[model samples]
Target: MQGSFCDNIVRSSTKDAMPDSLGNYLIPTSYSRIVARELGLQERELPRLLEGTGLPPHVLLAGDESRISGQQQLQVMTNARRISNDPAFGLRLGSQLTPRSHGPIGYLALSSPDLLTALKSLRDFLPIRIPFAQVDLHEQGQSMACDLTILLPAPTTQLRMLVECFALVIQSLVESFLGRELREASIHFEYDRPAYGDRYEKYIHSELHFAQPASRVVLPAHLLTEANPEGDANSYAAARDMCAALLEQVPVTALSMTDRVKRFLLAQPAGSVNEENVARSLYISRRTLARRLQAEGSSYRRIREDMMAEMAAVQLRQGQLSVESIAVLLGYHDSANFRRAFRRWYGCSPQSFRDGVKPE
Candidate 1:
């Protein structure tokens, strides 16, 4: 019922990028406890964060329960980085979070040739870690860019500051892993600079932007192909195999029909989520799909509306497109209908929603 990075991390077209279950992708609770102790944080804080997010503390220890809110997880990640001074703490924590047999994110890092590739791999699979943020990759003339645009639950003004801090930490982590001074790039925050910006320069070693359009880290295009001195090909292959094996061991029963339906819908384009289309894709008749929905305490109409509401809210808040245009994109007949629907779903007009969003 709460927000989760897992909910939005898997790009609709790329379910394969994620492991079959939530448990397969999380950091172990033991690791979280250890990290908390190391950082001088109360062990209870970790559990509290999970609990606040409506998740059980046990989920942190076992890869079996596999549900985490992006917001709550951010608190843990930020705490780790602040305490350890290890920028790659996320990746390191990741290595222990997943099944030990699978090597966590360590395998993914090893397979990369250069820091660029490693960063790319991180972006692709980042949903497994940080799901609420948009990991964007863009290429200008000779430069490449990477940014995480954070989307918080509506009405959280502090979400911008929190997201900005996390973005800086991510940039710091990438540079720390390579042992290179990320000289070519700039770390831009959508919010204004805090007094902490000076300390940031020691770790980031690049221009830092405050009050920018989006929070981002830009890189040189040539750096992507550069070979990573520490990279290992064999370990990467082994890790992949381990992940696949672990995935095979997890029973399908761990997931609900709603999760299955959601996964299927994630694989489809936005407009193709109708009952008939979903039924056809599932190789079932419309009546069968309806019956199953009834059994599950949900209906096709409910799920579709939920998806649209989520999509509409996120796009309206984060993206720069206009209301009318967004309406068209969401398959609405016109702006008026979109306005009415948005009012019903959110209790406010789209413009008001946009105006209320502070930059992160």
Candidate 2:
């Protein structure tokens, strides 16, 4: 990929700052199951692969309701690398991907009228499938490039695996759509060549370039207008609508601003719930964040207070921490301030609340 295109992808990817809170960006459990199946892993071996990932194999098998976060997914990738000992494991995984593996996004792309529309659908609906990454397409004179960027904090190995898997998956999808692979197509990796670098040739039949500035796949621009053999305009329209509806259900945009802010506070350490910090984490200016919260009939201070009160109630119910320690955990300067806040929140002192005495 061109250097300018790579730089644009990196810059745009960082513009939308995402919160690092656990479970902030979730991928459907079905995707995980697909990956495991592609790896030829047995059901019983999943736990060993996901040991330190804070993810349970049951969740991956839990149907469509369950989800895994970006961090946990990276951990799983790390574990997979360790167990498989195959540096090109990602390429192998990607080669196994079928349209059904992508859920609705895959189907929508499959039925689109042409390659370009299918790619556009993938770009628009990718967040619903994988929320922690963004894909952008750029068309130059004779070649078109699809750029992929991960938005979450991940280890280098996991990052490389993700990009490699995506590039291969896209290549497979396009070949399936067009009934053949483009001779001019190529895959580029931003990182240096690995010891098993030559193995990439086994999966990507086209030119493979390493140590490039970005992770991208370049294809002949004329391929964009080529009609998909299975294309049905009517089916594509329905699937596109369904994909749009699913995108709305993603957690980041599904919740109200107030609820989102409250969740952000719940995920942070005590005393780190100020407007500036929260706004920065959410990739919004202080004023815009305040306005949105206000539009939701709440404010940052109110949400923070609610979060603190909820946490205090849970802590008191657990009855493990003393009032003083609880106060400290809640960022109170002293027990007296905590007591005052408790009184304001629940009409009782901390001890009285902890003692099962109802405020009257």
Best by lDDT: 2
Top model number, TM-score? 2
Q: Positional deviation of 30 in candidate 1, in angstroms?
A: 8.7
lDDT of 1 at 151: 52
- Report lDDT (Cα) of residue 84, candidate 1: 63
Clash list (residue pairs), candidate 2: none
Candidate 2 wrongly placed segments (more than 4 Å): 1-24, 62-64, 235-360
Tens-place lDDT digits, model 2, residues 291-338:
988888899888778767876786687576678777876778788989
Q: Measured by C-alpha RMSD in angstroms, how accurate is candidate 1? A: 20.2
- The list of candidate 1 runs beyond 4 A from truth reads 1-38, 42-51, 62-65, 71-106, 154-177, 246-360
- The per-candidate count of clashes, in order, stands at 5, 0
Cα-lDDT of candidate 2: 0.70
Q: Please give the range of 10 consecutive residues that has the lowest summed lDDT in model 2.
A: 1-10
Each prediction's TM-score versus the true structure: 0.48, 0.59
